[model samples]
Target: MVIEGWGVNENIEMVDRVAHCANKLQGWGKRKRVKFKEDI
Candidate 1:
């Protein structure tokens, strides 16, 4: 039971990390798009 709980915690942490990365990428993309528009 303890092992199962630990596994669940690890999965949650992984998901959080992926979500954080995705948000960062999205923000970066938005900034790039805006810059491109201004350059045109």
Candidate 2:
């Protein structure tokens, strides 16, 4: 899910941050038996 027209550097950084958070949340959800509407 890319946002349009962001600067390259900012986009890369944001994607990295989002990916990290998604991974963390996925791990937490798995432990808690939570379901997400969509996979990241």
Candidate 3:
């Protein structure tokens, strides 16, 4: 989720929202790559 909100949620809830999303995507991508390699 590309979080681009401003207010109590974005300003106070989390600091590095985009970084967090990127990290999660990286992890998910890594898992998918591993699965694809295994399948091949």
Best by TM-score: 1
lDDT of every predicted structure (CA atoms): 0.66, 0.56, 0.64
| Best candidate, lDDT | 1
lDDT of 2 by residue, 1-40 (tens): 1232333456367677677667766667786664454443
Q: Write the per-residue lDDT of candidate 3 for residues 1-40, one digit (tens) a residue.
A: 3443223265543556656666777877899999999999
> How displaced is residue 7 in candidate 3, in Å?
14
How many clashes in each candidate? Answer: 0, 0, 0
TM-score of each: 0.70, 0.51, 0.62
TM-score of 2: 0.51
Candidate 2, residue 35: the lDDT equals 46
Instruction: Compose the digit string of candidate 1's lDDT tens values, residues 1-40.
Output: 3333335445467666666666767777899999999999
Candidate with more favorable, higher lDDT: 1 or 3 = 1
Model 1 residue runs over 4 Å out of place are 1-12
Model 3 shows how many backbone clashes? 0
- The predicted structure with the larger lDDT, 2 or 3, is 3
Off by over 4 Å in 2: 1-12, 34-40
Clashing pairs in 2: none
